[model samples]
Target: MNDEARGAFATRGVGLAGFDAPEARGLPPAATGVRVSSASDTVSRRALAHGQEQLRDGPVADACSALLRAAAGLRETDPAAARRALLAAASAAWSAGDHDSYRRVFAVGPCHLCGAGCASTPCARGCPEAAWRDHRIGMSAMAQGDFRRAIAVLEPRLHQVTPRAETDELCDAGSVALLLGRLPLARRLLSLALASARAAGAETAVPGIIAYLACAELREGRHAQARAHAEEGLVLARRLGQRNVAADLSAVRALVVSIAGDLPTVRAQVAEVLAVAQPHGLAQAAFLAEWAQARAELGAGKVERAAARLAPLVQPGARQGHFGLWFLAVPCFVEACVLSDRALDAPEMVDLFAVWADLGADPQAPAQLARCRALLAPADRSEELYRAALAHHERASGPYEHARTHLAFGMWLRRRRRPTEARDQLRAALVGFEHCGAVLWAERAGAELRAAGEVAGTGEAGPLSSLTPQQVRIARGVARGATNKEIAAELSISIRTVEYHLRNVFAQMGVRSRTGLAHLLANVDEDHGRGWELPDRG
Candidate 1:
């Protein structure tokens, strides 16, 4: 683990108190009437039923404790039932937003048969129900920054082709997958879990699963899908009185609308989420809500206000956002800092972002990192960095992020007296924003284009603008004397795809050769009152 990761955990007061404590072998002190012994199956079953009843009624903390105790009582008699009970405990703890209770239940201590906490795969003592033991150890390893071991241990348990596991079990795996940055796996698992919940008439489980699925889609850049799922989940959650799940869904909706630059909707969703999240200790929901607000602020050009708003969340402090979510917003925070001329205040967070980028969890991390470097780099170095960022964006999925990069690069070009190139980049950004329904950002790009001496959406229908965005990119690559292979590499597409686009580019422009294409582009540049000059990437 990196220093930033360690610092984040330390700041969050995350410790293995329950994982190593000997008292973990017994039922929680607050949990009464649960007798745990080798022959307490009937008692354990009753406790489990009571705990489930508590989940539907009230006092969720008591339910978690009771479930944990029931799991212990059933451990020696029925391994499957014990696993189910433990899974229920995890669900109850999560819905209550009780992190401490979650940790205490899942971070089981030493094995009853062996002194060690089943640190080995099979447990040298051949402990009964070693799967759950290994799972607990793996979870603890993850909490303690040993991700490699955790993945090795826990990943296999979730590898079933068509998982028919219990709803809570699937939900647990889905949550872990998300935390590990395995977006596709998280989506698949959670989707299956949602189906299972619905089929079993587990209405109480449905809202939380939908919330998780929405979160997965949001991170994967399926914003419209995320909003739909979040909206559905929010309705169900509110109807069921599951305020914590409702808060999470509301936060997800806020984030989705924020990307579209809908400030009013963002503000409304943020208010709804914070009202529940802050009072219920839903740190994940609160973090997403704050991030959505900061992003809306940044999009609206309130850079200083955005920076100030994000400082407490990204900086190392007691009030820092949830460890899982704070890193996701670091790129935005870095942009706000750079735009506000508080660049020096961001290197630490950037270093943390570097750690996140290295994890390869987020598909857009590489591009965002490049953009951050471009923002921080000197003028002589920033252009190539911006180009590098654009190249990275070609391989990523987020249209909003891709547009942001183009907008930034265009602003830089315009400031450098490269008005022609700035117009091209700003126009692309405007198109991207429009495609994604980001009205405010599209307007921002339009204004930038106008400031660069090219009237936004009012060109003489230039040949280059007539081409599709992909075709324009291919045509530009050809005009720059780049080979098909080179264009493929730059665009993160196949050479065949580049060649196909290039053929269409030639036909659309009525050009017979590369030289003709180049000449035509040069003529377009001359029309802008300046001869074309190759960009000096150095």
Candidate 2:
């Protein structure tokens, strides 16, 4: 970092964690998750030959030559001419086996310096085509959201540095590392690359590198440092007139603000970003910015508005694999849990936490498992599970992954009737999430304080205080838009029995309609430690 950037970070009490050597490399992955073990036939070889023959000369140059030819055939004034040119060039490059050409013509145009030295530069004749081919494929993989695949392809290339190399391999390897959750390695490698880019005056690409460093801080919970680097990168991007990079920086800034709980500012900045980024057809930035804006609304306790905003991003059949969308669910569900607590409405709210934990656990390591373990009711029954999950998460991504894990673990212990243990876990989680600017998440920590004094705080409304499991079950069924008949049928009881339970539920929960029944009962988190355990269901 320059003196200014370093000073800015120091001002925020942030420091570079310093570099450790690279981690052990894993095997390269395929373009898609679908891997084919079968060998290619002679026909595939012949097709590659024919395609290469189409561009026997400079691969990129030949691809451009094909595009220029296609565009010549279209009328100069034709509105569709640019698109037609692009399509035709892509087709020709495919035919010519020009992978670089195909990507330039077909893919989102960025990373402009990829093909500068794919082959052996000092060799009397360049290295074999297959040797250079994987890098071309790797670059394309990185452009896609397939981070695992990108990691695989770049691993061998990173370690294969030789005398004839035109560009350092560490730069590309570091880029992959950033995507794969290895932040320190990414920062170190990217910083070195940025220095070289600056010295060479490749000003075009510096913003991307700076953005990477900013992301390192974002991951580590240094919001201020991240914001500073992101802002600086934004200025550089705009100064260089790099719209794509600018859009990207703007989106990250919006995310930072949202995470910080600065909703009003996030809303305004995101609107500005969307307006500019959309016109440029920067879909990733536009989409992510919109999602982040909704996230801010969710954090601000504006539930309905947040749900509406998240609709597009989280809609069913939406192109999946959005990490942002997944993480945003944390606040959304927590808010739901809050509303449930306020209204005493949704028992499902508490259960939803369990579901979320189960969904994320198999893939998470031990330390992270601690977070999942938090989902269980505090008791001896789940302590082993919680500890096991913690062990897994910590192994996978270190202990300090996010505050939710700690806070949730505390809640789990509290539910298990381990109040002191719960208190300690909740306190740590509260402090951690608060420090990270995850306000909505951090605020939930106060629930533990309320939990500690819950008995003294609540008056026993006699009948309601003594609700039965069957009654709570029937109440939830009614609340879920189910008719008495459906509830009875599902519970394998008579309709009269269902009606009887419903009356008891309504009287106990204090509500008329299913909506009121469910909404009001969210107040059950107040059941904190009341010995109000439901009978075990078979």
Candidate 3:
């Protein structure tokens, strides 16, 4: 075998003779007297090749079963080769979404010809093929939404391999980081992966890497950059005939276009994505496409349609655990449920969001959980929950999410006959959506503004108008005679964040002193019917 193929087989835990030397390399020796004759080796190689060919062609489940059977046949004669075959089988099981089978194969150490006590041996220590075994287990964990475990298993191994191997490891680790909402880490890791793939001449890996980077940028609210990445990834995916990667990129592109209010393009892209993904059983891509469809329906004012589309995704059952992207879908699902008067159907999903939020690793989860709570909150408690959600979004620096909270809060205020406050929020949401290229949300905010009897862009723009949602909160706190520490406490933000926003507020308001800021805000509030209460300086 060539070096690349040898590395690939080795990485799959398929130990070939003369390559993976356990005793010679000072690793734990395999069972004694379990030698494979030359003919047996040839037959084993043929079986491995057939299994790989089947995987490349399709029908991954059948291929996995065949590999497992082959491994069983070789277990007594050649434990090392059997272990390799088992690794491939476990990986195939994972790819086919057979979590049960994968767990069955990987949850314990392989039985070296000495079946007894083999389970007690540490897989990593007793097996030279531990890296591949751990990688397969990590991937299965990721599919099951156990991101913490996936990261733990995969992160440390990124640098302990060839560039080609590092490319694959980086991609996996970066994907987990992205799902965990570690944007900077995800970006850094994916960038390195892309560079490594290029250095290794692994052109086929580039599209997948770029697709992940697009997702990271999308969550960061860099819509333009995300679109750029998605577009390039799509082109490469098509050129390489990688339908799965193409589907992923298409779904991402559809989401971007849907947010941009291009309903026709969104619809077409969704169709294309689903068409490719469903036939291949690409659950992640299908989920993303359905999510984009629901978002498009919501944008077009078809709340019921949106709710119907999301029902299967959010409803309790085995399906929930099947899609790792479900966490990202929670906010949209909650909005749909509430708007369609089906809020009662989502109590369980709300609980799920709460659990994810309690984990507190993903930056977006807390804000999304707060939004779901706000939607489900009683009339007396709704406003507080909305504000809390907005504060969480602000602290996370998620402008897109902050705008979504603003839009929801504005609609609630409008229904409560608080038009001035509603207009303020609506205007902010409009500006935020527009800035982020969320054309559909921008239009929705504009409609809400008109409903509040305010002409878009006609209201007198105050200095505070230019401030971000977070800065405005800080400015209001200062105008109310609250100190920085108090503002931080009230907003659930760091003291440093409060101080930073206060500085921005002062600069934007062109004020040199707190008194000056308070005085100016008072005048602006009165002039613009802001309805903010200015307390005595005391």
Q: Show the colliding residue pairs in model 3.
A: 13-84
Per candidate, the number of residue pairs that clash is 0, 35, 1
lDDT of 3 by residue, 128-237 (tens): 55554565555445434455675676556543534454676666556656645567777777788889998989987688688878877777777788899899998988
Greater TM-score among 1 and 2 belongs to 1
Q: Which portions of model 3 show Cα errors greater than 4 Å?
A: 1-97, 102-106, 110-165, 318-323, 453-538
In candidate 3, where is summed lDDT lowest over 10 consecutive residues?
15-24
283 in model 3: Cα distance from truth in Å? 2.3
Indicate the residue-level lDDT of 506 in model 3: 84
Tell me each candidate's TM-score. 0.72, 0.52, 0.67
Candidate closest to the true structure, highest lDDT = 1
Q: Once superposed on the true structure, which residue ranges of model 1 sit more than 4 Å away at CA?
A: 1-108, 113-128, 163-166, 455-538
Candidate 2 structure quality by residue, lDDT tens digits, 106-194: 23221212422322121124433333345444434433333345457655655444323322344545554554556666666766766
The predicted structure with the larger lDDT, 1 or 3, is 1
Candidate with better TM-score, 1 vs 3? 1
For every candidate structure, what is the RMSD over all alpha carbons to the true structure, in angstroms?
13.1, 15.9, 15.4
